[model samples]
Each structure stands twice: as structure tokens, then as C-alpha cells.
Target: MVVASRMLFRFSIVWFVAVVSCFSQDSSQTYEVYVSKNLIGTLIEAKIISKDVNSSKKILYHAFKEIERIDSLLAWQIPTSEISKINSYAGKSPVKISYETYSILERSLTYSESSNGIFDVTIGPLTQLWGFNGDEEPTTVPDKKAIDSCLKLVGYKDLILNSNDTSAFLRRAGMSIDLGGIGKGYAIDRASDVLKRNGLTSFLFNAGGDVLVSGYKAEDQNWTVGIKDPRKEDKLLGSVELTDKSIATSGDYERYFEVDGKRYHHIIDPFTGYPASNSVSVSVIAESAERADALATTVFITQGITGWQGTSDEEFLIVTNDLKNIFSPGFKKKYHFKSIK
Candidate 1:
């Protein structure tokens, strides 16, 4: 209860301040999707290129349903979820998972290894320990002792995967996996694939600004994406041209609280068990939404811009805690900033 109160308090402040800014040309047809019980919302716009409104709407409904199903299967806390079942077997034995679950976990482990454990999916305990698993402010900061205890529950190396058996096991009792970092982006990419398979092109799939663009807009203009200004919610820092790619932005300003003039945000460092400091936001544009989203969080947790080294070859933008900006080599070549002066 104490932890819940803190999370609620912090999120109340964040939502109170969040301002979503978007701009589009006049020729697009707008469609609103309200999937029952899904936490994320999406806005899809396509030109009137398709004459069949009924068919288009049907395609969208199925697409949304597919996303919801993926979320349900992967959610760790949901009692009936596949992940919950795997968690139920944490220390006893390797629990066999669905093919999809196995695939995502395999990919997550690969990413964790690639990032040198910087992008661990097994940081669930630390995430919830700091009052970030849900929406709220913590009643109090956890004691270093308690936090250290939870930190023991982390470590991607402890997760054992059996390829032949298609099973997963966490060596420790309390260790668990959380896909919050990459699940949404994976779902977006999957939905985009589904749409393409259904013969629908030229659509945008976005979940709270983690977006994927598969085809060109109706008028043949590139998909225009606006990056939110981390310092000012009502303003945009820049816009990027997306011919065929995905974009994901992670920022501290979207979820944070200030106490005694010190700020605490939602992005947690696996090594530190606290909100990562220095970088305020990181936006990644990549060939896959999953990679973009994972890298966004990974880059934000890395201090002193050293993390930029791993992404030097990719297209990305970094907004520092003090508002200093760093763009990847390709980002400046493809986009323009609205506010940098």
C-alpha cells in the first residue's frame, strides 16, 4: 500500500503536466481506435486511397485485437497471463513457454548480452521497488538495504534458456522478467506486419509516441514524425522524415516527481536501482521498433554521452538533463530541429 501511494502520487504529477503535441497536413483521413481494456491508444491516418471504409475498419479492429492479445500473453502480473505462469515456476524448473513467448525472451536475452547487461528484462523487482511498475508516487524512498536486497533479484545471466526444450528458468526465487522496455515496440512491429499481410499499406502504428511507419503517406510524402521537447511538453524539439522506419522516444520528463528539490523519474538504471541521471530523453529511429524502443531506454540510462558510442552508427537524438542536445551522425542529415537556439 505504501509503495502504491508513492507511485500514484508521482504519476498524478506527471500526467497532470504531460502535453501531447502533433501536427499533420490537411489531406489525411483520421481514425480513432479504442480497444477495450488496452492501456495504450493509437491514432491512424491514411489517405482516402482505399475506397472500402468497412474493409479498412475491419483491418484496424483485427490489428488492435492482435496487439491486445500479445499484451495479455506477456503481462507478468496478470494471473492468467503466460508470463505469470512462467513466474509461477521460477526456481523449481524450466517452464516451457509458447513459441511467441520463447521468441521474445530469446530476443530479449540477445539484446541484454549485446548491451552488456544494460538492457536487462530481469529488472522487474528494481522497477517496482522504486515505485515505477505502476502509476504513483512512493510514500517513501526505499531504504538502501531493501533496495540492495531487491537488486540481488536482478541479473540477466541467471535466466537459463533451453533451446531444445523451449523453456525458461530463473535461478533465484524472486527473479522475474519484465518486457515493458520492448513489448510495445514489438507489438507495433507485429501489427505493422499483420497490416501489410492484409494488403493494407500507408498506415502509421503509434503507441504513446513509439511509432512505426511501413509505407508512404497518401500524397507520397514521407511519414513526418515530431519529437516532443523533453523540457516543454507543449513544444516540439524537432521533426524527422520517415521513409520506411520506426521511432521510439524515452524521456524522464514524461514520468517523474520532485522532492526536496531532487527529481526522481521512471527510467531506472539496472546497476544503480534509481532513476538514471544526466540524460533527460533519448529518441531512436531504427529499422525495427523493438530495437528503437530498447535503445531509447538503454541510452537514457547511460551517463556522460558515452552510451552514444554504441549508437554512433544509428540515427538517434539525445536531450540531456540540462537540455544539451546530441544527434547521431544520420539524424541531422534527415531531420531539422524546431528549437535548438
Candidate 2:
């Protein structure tokens, strides 16, 4: 009887441990990662749906490599990239680009044209002149003379693309292309693709606040992602449940310069040559992180009911400068947002 009783006690303890482990697995398991690059800073947290803690390290390494590739391609200061090559072709014939660079630049131009110039990639010179390209201090706004000179060089129409050759070129020498607004989110999408292809059953990857989610939690559990409150970093304005989707946020809060008590953010209006003023922030939800990344900036720069009317097939959820949130009709049903006080 003593032996039998001891056996029963051990069985009970085993069952208890099993139950506790199950509960812990269901809650969420997130791994922290720090990657140093771009002077722009990249922070990401990945939550994979599994109890095996060892897999987290592998995922972190994979993500780090993916982000590094993006940084190299999109970093404006990096003088030996496809972006720089395109910039060099300015004021000359269209410079042929690699297949990869041409694809991204082509998509950028499409978004620019589709949004009616709200998402211009050719605004680099103006962005730099305004000191948004990591400049330490604000210079006076570029005068009408400077802007008009640059405007001649600006214009998506002037961006020459050869579909047959898969190359891109700018019409003027002073013209430059900066992918700052959209590159990270595109990188997040690419990284997520790598994870999924590698058999990562479920994962969430966020570059800064641009987020992409794939698969589900353990055994069919959905993933929940919180949209950061633009006004308060510590607060989450809302939570969205996703099985496969991407979320990207663009806001005046992301990066900016201040002069004369006015804040000039990184999202510049291609038409006005100034930081867009309509919305303080805009968050977009789409089927792919790439589209979400580009549209968030496009929506912010456009800033209105029609900010992204014809940009892409992807849907969106946008928050205005006044804190009033807008959602594409289809996207409205997907999540719950905390009410603003």
C-alpha cells in the first residue's frame, strides 16, 4: 500500500506539471533582440508559438541578417548601393539597375503615380535640404527659388524605367532616391517570408513598430499585436488579432526636426515640399508587410479621406492628426481599439 500510494503521488505531480506547462505555452513567448545599424536604430521583438525555447535564438539570427541586408540597400549614406546607383544616373540617361532594385523602385513609382504624387521617391533632394535625412539641425525652409529648382528635378514622370532591361534612372543630376519611409517594412516582410519558408510555424516580426504576423499560435491559436499609441510610447492604442497579416504605422512621432516651435516630420508631401500636416500618424493593415510599409507613408503624406484611394489592392486603418481613426471598410471588422480619452 505504501508503494502504491507513492506511485499515485508521483503521477499527480506529473499531471500538475503538465497542466502548468500548457498554460505557460498558451500565454505567449516573446524573444528580445537588439541589432545595431543605420544610426536609425532597429528594435524588434519576435514571438513564436512554441514551448521550445531553443528555437528563439535561431529566429533572432535569421531576422538580424535580413534586416542588415535591407539597411545596406536602403541606407542613404551607403554610397555603393542600388539607390546610390540610381541617384548617380540622375541628370542623365536612365541607369539600368539590378533586378531586385528595379523591382522595388518600380513599385515605388507605381505607388507615387497611383497616389497622385503623394508617395514620390524622387523627393530625396528636397528631404535632405529640409534636414530630414538625419541632419542635426534645421536650416530655413528651402526658399521658393530652391524648391522650384528642385521641383524641375522632382516628378515621377521624369523617373525613367525600362521594363525590358529592369533598370531605373533619374532625369537630373541633383535628383536622389531615398527609401527611408518604406524600406524597413519591406524588410520586415522579407524577413517574415524567410521565417515562414524555414518552417517557422507561427511568428510575429516587428521592425520598430512595423509588424508582420504569420501562421498562428501553438495548435491553431491566433496572434495578437498591439498598435502603439503615437502620443504615448508605453501605451497601446489597440490590439489586432492576426493569423496572417502585416501592420505598419507611420507617424509624425517617428522622426522629425523642430524649428520655430513647429515640428517637421519625416513624411514629406511631394507637392508642398514640407512635412505633411494632415495626420499626426497613420497605421495600415495589409496582406503583405511590403505594401503596408509603403502605404503607411503614402497615407501619412497624403493625409485625407483619399490618401490611398488607388495605391494598391491592400486595405488600411489610419489614425488622423486629431486622433480620429479611419479604417478601410473591410479592415474595420478585424480588431478592437481602445477608446481615446
lDDT of 1 by residue, 1-341 (tens): 99999999999877665532134233345433323233533343323224456677677777777787888888886777777777777777888888898899988998888778888999888877877667566646678997898888899999888889888898888887888899889888887777788897777777777888866765657767888888886888878778668889988886677878887888888888878886888998888889898888888888524654344445778888778788877787765434532
lDDT of 2 by residue, 73-168 (tens): 766678877788778778877766677777888888888877888888888888777775653756466687886676666788878889898878
Per-prediction CA RMSD (Å): 17.2, 6.4
Report, for all candidates in order, the number of backbone clashes.
10, 6
Name the top lDDT candidate.
Answer: 1
Please give the TM-score that candidate 1 achieves against the real structure: 0.84
> Against the true structure, what is each candidate's TM-score?
0.84, 0.81
**C-alpha lDDT score of every prediction, in listed order:** 0.76, 0.73
Regions of candidate 2 where Cα sits further than 4 Å from its true position = 1-40, 310-314, 338-341
User: TM-score winner among the candidates?
Assistant: 1
